[model samples]
Target: MAQPRRRATPTKRDLLRADLRRSTPEELSHALQMLLDQSRLSRDERLHALASALVVEALAPYWVGDRTPNQAHDALCADDEELARVIEALAPMLLGHIEVREEARDAVATIEAMLGF
Candidate 1:
């Protein structure tokens, strides 16, 4: 008798893609429109958006109902010094998002490369 083969576990990316495939046409259209809008944003604006997304993910464990991701980003931006510090701290994590690592590039540059902008 042949031994049974085990199935490979699904990765987060695989699961996400599967879920996306099941989305309604309207939902897919809305998602596509949002991506298109993001692509149209200026470099600075797109950098801000990427930083906000990073902050949102990092802060999710501590996020409360009253504080939204945009609100959290706004509060962080209000303190320019702190914002710089936060960006510096988040810079190492940005490495995982991009394919190639360039020496001495800032977070904005890394994000631009990640986004292909």
Candidate 2:
């Protein structure tokens, strides 16, 4: 008898990360806006924190060199106010963290410049 093949299930974090990675700049911005808007109505502190963290992760690609800073800037030019607002809210938190990886510094710097901070 042939053995049955088991399908692997992705964990929530893995799924979220993949979705963020696949999103275009506009789609990613919209997703972050939704998460931020949802976080406001939810009273769960953990949920809010998770949403914030996910937003940060979603923004990481812009800073990670896989996506150029100019691409992010161009997306910003498309008038994504929610994306701008989310970036303004999250940039400080990301910059203040002590554990940010060295590779992410350039991306972070790009974000800072974009935000005029």
Candidate 3:
């Protein structure tokens, strides 16, 4: 006997996907161009962050556990060399998009200045 398959849970963008599908393909193409023009900067950042996160995940497949990534906030404390290389490679690529995040720290500064976080 075959059981009917259940529908998958919808992602946040699922409504947009559904709307696009209902639209004429030609209309959808036009809408895409308009949306891109309006939100190019946000789109660029999202793509870059997604790419960096995916690269890190792909590099450490065996590190799978039961947390929604950075959820535990402790994974960042682990010591590993390959992890170092992963971060180093991603730093320059991400600098332009995240200049504030890429700033260097000064250990000799006053407490408040040193805590520029």
lDDT for 9 in candidate 1 is 51
Q: In lDDT terms, which candidate is top? A: 2
Residue 83 lDDT (model 2): 77
Question: Which scores greater on TM-score, model 1 or model 2?
Answer: 2
Error of 1 at 32 (Å): 9.8
Candidate 2, superposed: residue stretches over 4 Å from native: 1-52, 56-66, 77-79, 99-117
Clash statistics: count for each candidate:
0, 1, 0
TM-score of 3: 0.27
As a whole number from 0 to 100, the lDDT of residue 15 in candidate 3 is 39
* TM-scores of the candidates in the order shown: 0.28, 0.29, 0.27
- Lowest lDDT 10-residue stretch of candidate 1: 95-104
Best by TM-score: 2
Q: Write the per-residue lDDT of candidate 1 for residues 1-117, one digit (tens) a residue.
A: 998975455444444464467789776655544553535677655665666576665555445679876565555566555754685577655654443434436777888999999
lDDT of 2 by residue, 25-45 (tens): 887765655554544454444
